[model samples]
Target: MKKIEVVAAIIQHDDKTLCVQRGPAKFDYIHHKFEFPGGKVESGETGEQAIIRELQEELRLDISKADYFMTVDHTYPDFHITMHGYICPVESREIVLTEHIDAQWLSINELPQLDWAAADIPFVEKLMAE
Candidate 1:
């Protein structure tokens, strides 16, 4: 199976982490699934660059500082994906969402409150264990 490589920003503020729910714009089984804000790394772009670009486009926010977290590989019924997770620190709690249906600032303890995208579950588990 072919693999799709992506990057994600686990943007956190204080004790709250930023999570986004996919909008109707996404496809079946993918849409409405909760996830960190980010997207696929385009050709010629580094994973860091991709997350930075995706953040600007999706949330209209900037991540001035970020720390590498972990990489996870996941296979869904339809496709396989590799995700690079980063802990992105932003200057503001404000965001303007253009792609997602909804956004939330939830504590790590609340991470399991919503249904998450399959691939993101591993990272979530890793996060809470920290």
Candidate 2:
């Protein structure tokens, strides 16, 4: 198995965290679950750079800064992924929604109600604790 690094942006505004519905391609693991907006960190790209670039490309907004939130190492049957999660406040409200089917900002208290990706459970717990 190969190691993959992913950057996830956990943007929060007015106590709501920005989440997106995973695309059809994610059926293997996440399926239709909701997740923080982000993606894989390409080779030679720093974690911060990956988050900034991914957010810009996926959401069409300029991310000012990404604050480190948590780092999680998750293993699946086929591969292992290390995710660097960040909480960044969005400067622009405009989102392109290129890959995801839907997006929304949900309150921390209501996070448990949403069907989230399995790996997101720990991150959401940390967010709720804060």
Candidate 3:
């Protein structure tokens, strides 16, 4: 089995967290699931670098800083992922959605109401506790 290592940006503003829906999935289980926007940590890049790059490419938002939050290791049916999460506050700019199908800034209490990727559930749970 292949292991995927990635970083997720838990971007927040004014007490709300940004969540984006996956653009499309060939697999039914993953389609439309809400998630923090981010991408894989390419070789030779730190988690911080990865999230910064991913956000810029995926959302067109500049991450001023990414503070470490939590890490999640999850095994799906076909792959496993070790994900590093960071609490990223963006620079003042409008978000341009480039990859996700939809996005919403939801209250922490409402975070769990939407369908989320299996790997992101623990991160969301941990966030709600804060």
Number of clashes recorded per candidate = 0, 0, 0
Error in Å for residue 77 of model 3: 0.6
Structure candidate 2, residue pairs in collision: none
| Per-residue lDDT over 12-43 for candidate 2, one digit per residue giving the tens place of the 0 to 100 score | 77667788988786347777789888889988
What's the CA RMSD of model 2 in angstroms? 1.4
Q: What does the lDDT come to for candidate 3?
A: 0.90
Clashing pairs in 1: none
Best by TM-score: 3
Task: Report the poorest 10 consecutive residues by lDDT, candidate 1.
Answer: 23-32
Q: What is the per-residue lDDT of model 3 for residues 22-120, given as tens digits with 9 covering 90 to 100?
A: 968886777889998898999999999999999999998987799999999999888898999999875453699998999899889999998999999
What lDDT does model 2 reach?
0.84
The segments of candidate 2 whose C-alpha lies over 4 angstroms from its true place after superposition are none
TM-score of each: 0.94, 0.92, 0.95
**Candidate 3 residue spans exceeding 4 A from truth:** 91-93
How far in Å is the alpha carbon of 66 misplaced in model 3? 0.3
Candidate models: Cα lDDT each: 0.90, 0.84, 0.90
